[model samples]
Target: MYQGIYGSSKKHESDLDHVINRAFKSGVEKIINTAGTHQETIQALELCSKYENLYTTCGYHPTRCNELNESNEDEILKQMIDLCEKNAEKIVAIGEFGLDYERTQFCGIDQQKRYFEFQLKHLISLKKPLFLHNRASSQDLYDILYKYRDEIKAGGVIHSFDGTLDEALQFIQLGYFIGLNGCSMKIQNNLDVIKQIPLNKILVETDAPWCGIKQSHASYSHMNTQFTSELVKKEKWIAGKMVKDRNEPCTIIQICEVIHSIRDKKESFDELCETIYLNTKHLFFSDQ
Candidate 1:
């Protein structure tokens, strides 16, 4: 099992440590983190190195590409590249890299695109799997991905998935696996998406410190005919549940619980464990 911190929104310090330790106790032997910045990467590496199971994924997040200051862009990129090369054995992937139009606090599309392409080329050369991020930029992202689909034949997931069934089908066609997280359980539409997704193509994540599933307080919010109502409710629940609890990696068990509830099989745990384990290995360990 994978068991390291996620480099998304900042998780509570104690919670982060709790998740890592709990996962370690539960027999998780590896984890892929998205250290979206250089400092964050270094800190996580320092904290998690004691555990032989922990690993890191370093890159700028789609929404945080603006954090890549113009003056420091080249230097930061070089540092990231060097870190990846130096710790190639420890850093398994190069991402949380993609496009996010949902939040414009970051740079414009062009800048995001530039860094994304740069990282793609870098990882392709390294022949590593990606820990991707894409939200509200699926079409454009898909278009760009298709161009390099063959050249960057090593595939990755669109993390914290929020795309349509058709869009997901397109990704599968391109040899990408879909990442299902707590959002999958809290969001009913994603629940529909989850049911339809092939067992072999699904992987689970918490995206913790964010995207927590709020099953307890959100079970009965009324909704309009449009799915938008439910989507909003779900997003709120995911955020509230995760953050309210300090959002840690060990919450992966909560993620599994939600998945089990949706699939409605008492045996979901065993099946899910086996399928997700195999799926993760198939994607990340194919070359191994």
Candidate 2:
């Protein structure tokens, strides 16, 4: 939502309230707004305070790691920790942070690894679960996470997971949950990997308004359902209408339906939904 719909620079502000209301009406019980920078983290917390059942994460994304340097890294880390401490009730995790090797042009490998480890080392003390992001840097990401496994007692979710089955198993073995979203089902292999994830260790998300499923995705064949909201191009967006190609939280049902179609038939659709909901609660809202 921060990157696409609700942020200061986004164009869909006129329909923001409608979109959020649609999500809750569609049976979305809670929303976790992920922050990718120190500034976004603050914004997420402020936004969460205005709405019920809304939560946020705290940390910088790998692609935005360049914002840190020897001069400001310590101050930024302090600021993140202060936000977590002051608003512990709303700040559920310590990420949107991890390695994204695919976009090294935005921030080089050395910087990404350095700050990824830096955040992991510093933020683990907060005892919050992680909201991680890993793209094409699994081994290095795993190594870093594995190094700090014992300290991460709350566990975490690898949000928008797009890794091999072996990699998924490794993260699960480390007691992490695999977060499946629209982007997670983009290809045949993605579907295959998600199919093998144990039901108890899976969480589903929209990762909106970014990872909405597309017709070209392998999982689209299973999506015989859709939301009825009118779609319009962002340039011609109207209040109460969804922007075309911009994902919203209400589309999460389609994601769950796709998972139901691809997973073992032994579990009914309601059972699958229940299992994923419980998994999410276990990781991010266990105290409640």
Candidate 3:
């Protein structure tokens, strides 16, 4: 089985090892990771190369877009770009970078503009696909992408898609695939959104160690549901019931479950898996 893993983790906590171990044990042999810093990307490369199933994408995050101006940014970017050029056989995509206005108010638009454009330029030259993360700044993100759509040698994916069907359609038009993860299964409203999206444009991700779905009812009662007064408690608990474990790639099955439920056909599991595997291979490994 082939699976995609997205994140920007540092060393010592690089979960790729755990994921590689589990994936191999479960008959999975491929993973695509998104790296935060130059050093992090190098570390991921070292680890993934050892495992043979792991691959990574290198880029700065929107929150750390400021790092692009640091002294190390150019040195690091050069190193990463050279690595991508020499080891194009190993890297899969070029991001985890985009706009995150919700989390990066201090960075300002210009900083994001400069860094994002810079990374996009490198991505264009490298001819590698991307893994983008856009939160609340989809308008400008789409604007830039559209302006350069034709020039982008390698199209990419939008990770953790949370936009409306209309917005989702926009990205689909640009040769970008939508990455559906556990987050899609958490919000009730997104269920319909998930159902509306076509399966061919979809790819499953876990975004492990973060972005897991939980039933809010399960969390509130994890310790005191029994002690609470009956009058205070409603017939049905809706706070938190199921907690998603952090940092395990095997949980990708949960994402498949969401797709199966929304598509309303169980037989699609095999087809779905094969389709996603083909999608990934076509997008990243076609030229390889």
Candidate 4:
């Protein structure tokens, strides 16, 4: 909810309340608002205060790693620690952080790695589960996390995962969960990797305002149902109606539906949903 439905700016600010309420009406029980910068984390905390079920993460995203440097690194990291300590109850994770080589143009490789490790070393004390991100930099990400495996007591999730089966297994073997979203199910290979991951190691998310499932995606054909909300262009925005092509938490049902369709038939949809729900609770909401 930090950005408007369009995601690039605050053009659709008025529609946010309706969008969140719609998600609840559509059966989404909780949401974890991920932040990529200090300011965004503050905004997320503000939003979380407004909704009891809404929680958040605090850290710099790999693409946004350029914001950190030797000059401000200590100050920024201190701010992150302060935010986590102050909002420990609401801050469930210490990321949206990790390496992202696919978009290294935003931040060079050295800068990304330096700051990513900086946060890992500095924030591990929070002992909160991580909300990780990885894209085309799985090897580096795994290597870094593997080094700190013993220190990461609360474990983490490789959110928006779009990696191979081996990569997924490696992370799971490290006691991390694999988060799947529209982006994770875009291709046939994505579906194949997801199919092999055990149910207990999987967590589904919307990655809203982005990663909306498309008809062209391999998993689209497997969806047995669709979100019934009427889709309208952002320019033609209407209250209670969804923006065209912009993902929201309400559509998370489709993610579960697609997974159920692709996964083994031995487990019924209800059973699969229960297993995933419990897995999520174990990782992110264990305190509750």
Best of the candidates, lDDT = 4
- Candidate 2 C-alpha lDDT tens digits along 1-288: 423444546664456578888889878999999899989988887778788888999998999999999999999889889989999999999899999999999999999999999999999999999999999999999999999887888899888999999999999999999999999999999988888889899999988888999989999988866654577777677777777888999899888888888985659999998999999998899999
**Order of the predicted models by TM-score, top scorer first:** 4, 2, 3, 1
Predict model 1's lDDT versus the native: 0.68
State each model's C-alpha RMSD to the native. 7.5, 2.1, 8.4, 1.7
**Residues 168-252, model 1: lDDT tens digits:** 8888888888987755555567677767777678887867666655544231132111222223221133321223333456556
State model 4's lDDT: 0.89
lDDT computed for candidate 3: 0.70
Write the residue-wise lDDT of candidate 4 on 1-288 in tens digits.
324534455555576788789889888899998899989999999989999889999999999999988899999888889989999998999988999888989999999999899999989999999999898999999999999989999999999999999999999999999999999999999988888999999999999988989999999998876764588777766677787788889888888888998886659999998999999999999978
Which portions of model 2 miss their true places by more than 4 Å?
A: 1-13
Which run of 10 residues does model 2 get worst, by summed lDDT?
A: 1-10
Q: List the residue pairs that clash in candidate 1.
A: 2-30, 3-30
Deviation (Å) of 162 in candidate 1: 1.5
lDDT ranking, best first: 4, 2, 3, 1
lDDT, candidates in the order shown: 0.68, 0.88, 0.70, 0.89
